[model samples]
Target: MLKGEKLGAAIEAARIKKGISKAEMARHFGVKPPSVQGWVKYGRISKDMLPRVIRYFANEVGADHWGIEPGDPYAPDNLVQLRPKLSAAEGMVVIDRLSVQAGMGAGKLAEHFPDVIDNLRVSKDWLRRNATFTSMKNLGLVTGLGDSMEPTFSDGDALLVDRGVRDVKVDAVYVLSLNDELYIKRVQRRPDGAWLMISDNPSYEPYVIENGDRDHFQVEGRVVFAWNGRKL
Candidate 1:
C-alpha cells in the first residue's frame, strides 16, 4: 500500500545503496539541486525528472516485485509519519545529561559531575543499561538540537556517540554546542583559536566558531554512534 512520498523514500534509499549523491543525480537529470531534494523530501520526482532517475538507477527496482508495505520499505514510520515525542520530564533529563557532558545545559550547578551513581562512568554499563552491557560497550547517545547539523542529523534524532573523547582531532565528528544549541559535525581545530564545523551532507554550508565565541561553545562529547526511533 505504499503511495506518494513513501515510494519516493524507497527510491532514495536505493539510490544511497548504489553510492550516488543527490547533487550528482540532479546533474544527471539536468535539473536544479532543489528539484532533486524535492523528490527525496516528497517521495515524488516530477514526471519530467522520473525518466532520468529511472535511467540512472535502472538496476535497483525489484524484479517481479512483491507487494510493498504501507510505509518505508526500511524504517517505515520514520519515512511515513511524525514520530511520537518523549514526555517533557524525560526529554528534560536527556537534555540535561547532554548539557552536563558538553559543559552547559540550561541551569548552573555547583557540582556538575555526580558523586551519587557508581554506574555513571563512561563504560559499557553506562551505555547499555542492562544485565550485560556487552552489545553497547562502545556506544553513547546525544541529542541533536539544530539545523546546522541538518541532513546528517535531524532536530530530534538521539545520536549514537562513540567512546573517543578528549582532544578534538582533525576530521573527527563531535557533538558540540555554541550559544546553547547543540550540533553534531566534523571538527577540525584551527591554529588560530577557531574551529570549522563541517557538515557531512554537502547540501549545507560550512561555518566556523571564533575565539570570542569559544566560551559559549564546548565539545559536549564526540559522536561514535547514533540512534533514532527509525534507526539504530
Candidate 2:
C-alpha cells in the first residue's frame, strides 16, 4: 500500500485547498462519494484508488505540491532527454513504442526500433504499488492484435509490457515469442506441470503444453497495462 498517514493528510489538505468537495471529488474520479468520504475520514487511500487520487494531485496541484516528482521511470538508459521540464527522478515514466507487434493469436515478427514515440505520465506511488522493477529497465510498449484478449486488450491497442516479469507469476496476461513471432496470451500453470496459454475470449482454444518443451516458445514479457483511442 501507500505511505498512508502523511499521504492521506496531504491529499486531504490538497483537496481542501482545491475547494473540491468529497462528492465533487467522487464525480471527478467517477467513483462514489463514499470512497472519497472514507479517505477524508480515515486519512487513507487504498491501492486501487491511488491512481485516480494521485493523478488529481499531479494534474490539479502538481507533483511538487504532494512531495512527489514526475518523470518516466521506464525510459531506456541510452535515451537521453526523457522529458522536458522533468528530471529523471521526478517525472512521468517515459515508455517508448516499439515496432514489434504482439499478436493475440498468430503473431507477426516485425523489425523493432528503439524510437521514443510517446510520453506516458503515471503516479510514482501508483507505479511503486504495481511495478517492482524500474519502468525504464523493465518496461516496453507494443501494439496488440487479434480478438483473443478482447475487452482486456482490444485490437490495435497500445500495451505496456513489463520485461521484469519474464516468468509466469500466476495466471495472468503475458507476452511470449513463439517461433520468432510475439504474442500476448493469458497463461496459467496447470496441476500436471504443463502450462496453459488461454485467451480471454472463450471463442479461441487454449494452447497447452509441457514446461520441458521449451522449443520455439519464449517468454517476452508480461502485460501491465493497455490503452485504446477511439478516433471519433
What residue runs in model 1 are displaced by over 4 Å at the alpha carbon? 1-139, 145-150, 162-166, 191-193, 228-232
- Using TM-score as the measure, the top candidate is 2
Candidate 1 per-residue lDDT, tens place, 57-119, comes to 433443112123444333233221222222224212221123222211221232222111101
- Which ranges of candidate 2 are over 4 A from the true structure? 1-91, 110-114, 129-136, 228-232
**Where does candidate 1 have its weakest 10-residue lDDT segment?**
111-120
What lDDT score is found at residue 20 in candidate 1? 80
Q: Score candidate 2 by lDDT.
A: 0.65
Model 2: lDDT of residue 72: 32
List, residue by residue over 33-109, the lDDT tens digit for candidate 2: 77777787665666655544654443234444445433433223222232232323574564556656888877878
Residue 3 local lDDT, model 1: 38
In terms of lDDT, model 1 sits at: 0.49
Worst 10 residues of 2 by lDDT: 74-83
Residue 150's lDDT within candidate 1 is 50
TM-score of each: 0.35, 0.55
